[model samples]
Target: MLSEASNFWGLFKSGSKEREFRKAVEQIIGEKPSNPLLYQLAFRHTSASKETNIGGFRESNERLEYLGDSVLGMIVAEYLFKKYPFKDEGFLTEIRSRIVNRESLNQVARKIGLEKLIQFDGQRIAHNRTSMYGDAMEALIGAIYLDKGFRFTRSFILKKLIANYFDLDAVIQTNTNYKSILLSWAQQEGKKIVFEIVQENGKHHHKEFVAQVKVNGEAISTGGGWNKKKAEQEAARRACESLEIKSTQ
Candidate 1:
């Protein structure tokens, strides 16, 4: 453990940076942070830095992101369970998935200024990977869990993150399942729809996928993502925007 003097000096040395971080946190979380290390790890991206200068095995925020993902899901589930006691399991699960999905999380993170605050190596790569901000948000949640315990983390997620950021009623009324939406519309219109993986590129550790959404044997739109499912989802979302207006279905 670091001595009090050492900790004080450490804070003194990092006073400027800490002030910046504190301001950012206040904007995001609506309060000053008691532990800043967790927030640091939350913004640290693997693409930007691999191994930390510290002696431990941690290289990036991947582990923290993993932990945060599970924790956030559980909290969302519990919140949904309590809020929608009469709703069935399927309804709760589907709504929870929408609330915690990559695109939705990324949107929330970007809206909360995390995209500007996130640390990464290159601008191009960082901008290209849309999920980076979302991943950082999850990792930050993990950090919050470790530093502030479950009660604080839960409040932050439900009250600050979900309540303030997301529109659950809008989400419930509108289906974000692009694939299902496309399929149902095509079926109603008596048209054929297909999603094909046209390309897969990137390093072994990180893969990029390009998916094309074809409607009635014509490629309507294309989108790329870190995974095929996400790519397909994007493609379908694009297809909906393009074809939806044209078809009454």
Candidate 2:
């Protein structure tokens, strides 16, 4: 299931495929899903979207991911607020961002065996499949919220995700903002650094951008992402790696 597969036959169909997928989801989430369609859509990447019979609407996880992003953010914020009663907003926000950032979520999704269930077009998005797993993780949270309720979803996130996958002390001590680090290094070294979008691919909602970093008019590194900012950060990350610039932030 890690590899890309074709689209689901229909939104309402409950065939063997759905059953298999349901079992897989149960193993990952440790709960039986009430509605299979939502969970199915949770792992469905945009490249693997299917056109519905009505209105020619393509069904993907984008909408679910949007909902899950907000839900996850709120849940994390609430948890951080309660756990660190004396901490300021800035500290909580930073912790939440570190926990929910693309690379962090991507690593968590892989650890939770989400890669086996995600369905994407490997051929179509071969080179730019950076954050699809993390996106799917958010979409899965949305599905869990809809399938269960807020209370159950909150518990699931707190117990199943944050408690299991993250160590708050380690997360607090780490800073992976490559762009900020690169900028700081450039400022200290008095070197001019620029990030340029070299290429853009895919549709409007599912666009992939390639960013190149140039220091003193010489291209240093290039990287890709689902958006421009991510792309730039990726490029900067590579530049940092190449230059052996350790993060000071």
Candidate 3:
């Protein structure tokens, strides 16, 4: 935790470029970062990474993104669990996915001004920016978690990101319905689609179902869930991604 006076003096002493980045981050997150280096690492894209240590190890936001992904999922899961106490596991899972999906993260990241701070090879990723902003968003979460710990990070997510950007009613009402979309696409393309329960684990209420979607007798994708329908829907969603089929929603 940097004192306000120290933070201002530190910024005053830093290089012009460093001061700019620090100020930008402070504006985005609504606080002075205790450790600015973490934020710097968080915005570093792999495209602009350089080998920094032993063997082919490079410094980039990937590791932070991985950590942030888990943290984000847990936070969202807990939020959904409490917000919709009457909802089942499937409902919670689906809603969580909708909230943290790549597209949603990307949109949120851009909306929060991360796109300007992310250090990426623009020419290299000019056509592949879909996941870039989203990845940096996760990394930023990880950095926040490290710097401020879970409680503060959670508050920031719920208050700053979720409260400002997400509409719970809208998210709940919107249906991508990947299964229906995949089926319709299969019918139009004359491809036979079959969803089969490949595996079931555990017993009773805790059991998990794995569904595999096969097209023309070959497996296209597989998904797992607490129920058969949800598992098949996940498989359909993956298959749609593989087939480049856009959702109607």
Candidate 4:
């Protein structure tokens, strides 16, 4: 029952579950769904997927996900532009990114009760399925656009999704970009900030890097990751914690 059309529609002769799904869709979008197939595909994860023609595999809503990502970004950008007409580009960009980021979208999807609707492989990927939720959220946006057109999609996004899920004030007050926060604070306080790669190893596809963050030439903290940037970010995060730097980006 992993988002197959038949499974969704023909699950019960009574159509009780079908009615529930219909109600759920209406609740989520504030309108009746015109195209059920698109909604089905939006909830279909790659793990329990059907093969496509041309010898290709699209087990997930990845294509739709990509489309949704673009659509969501554009809508958010427009909202930000109109809402904060006087704010600078950096502030708008950061806030827009925060709204459309994976974690935020995942939370939004969960808030809208997409977890029960989304179909995925049972056990595998469940441990770290936050990205899956986020991806499905984007795919739903793509579905809305395709089924209802841009204007309706925009209304759903701005009036329903963003208005209900996204918190503008919290995002403006909080700073999740640890590296940027650390760098900016260091510059303000006249502290010399430097990042150095302490170690690098592993094969081409699975290389690992260890990085250290230094403040005033003293080792603040060290962290490791699959790439230098990731390692540096982790190191910066550790440094922020160690130095008690208030994350106000």
In terms of lDDT, the best-performing candidate is: 2
Whichever of 3 and 4 has more lDDT, that candidate is 3
Runs with alpha carbons beyond 4 Å of true place in candidate 2:
1-17, 184-194, 201-208, 214-221, 241-244
**Over 4 Å off in model 3, which ranges?**
1-14, 177-249
- Taking the tens digit of each residue's C-alpha lDDT, what string does model 2 give over 1-249? 223343433322556766777887888778889998899889888877889998999999999999999999999999999999999988889889899888888989989988777777755665245688899999999999999989988988899999999999889878787887898899999999999999998875467899999999999999988889899989999999999999764
Backbone clashes in model 1, listed as residue pairs: none
All-Cα superposition RMSD per candidate: 6.4, 3.7, 11.3, 5.0
Clashes of each: 0, 0, 0, 1
RMSD after Cα superposition, model 3: 11.3
lDDT of 3: 0.83
User: If both were scored by TM-score, which would come out higher, candidate 3 or candidate 4?
Assistant: 4
Model 1 poorest ten-residue lDDT run: 1-10
**Between candidates 1 and 2, which one is better according to lDDT?**
2
What is the lDDT ranking, best to worst? 2, 3, 4, 1
Worst 10 residues of 4 by lDDT: 1-10
TM-score for each predicted model, relative to the true structure: 0.77, 0.80, 0.70, 0.77
TM-score: model 2 vs. ground truth: 0.80
After superposition of all CA atoms, the RMSD between model 4 and the true structure is 5.0
Clashing pairs in 2: none
Candidate 3, position 129, lDDT: 24
The 10-residue segment with the lowest total lDDT in model 2:
1-10
Q: Give the runs in model 4 whose Cα sits over 4 Å from its true position.
A: 1-16, 127-129, 186-235
* Per-residue lDDT of model 3, residues 80-167, tens digit only: 9999999999889988988997778989999998876777654444414237788999999999999989998899899999999999
Clashing pairs in 4: 46-59
Error at 123, model 2, angstroms: 3.4
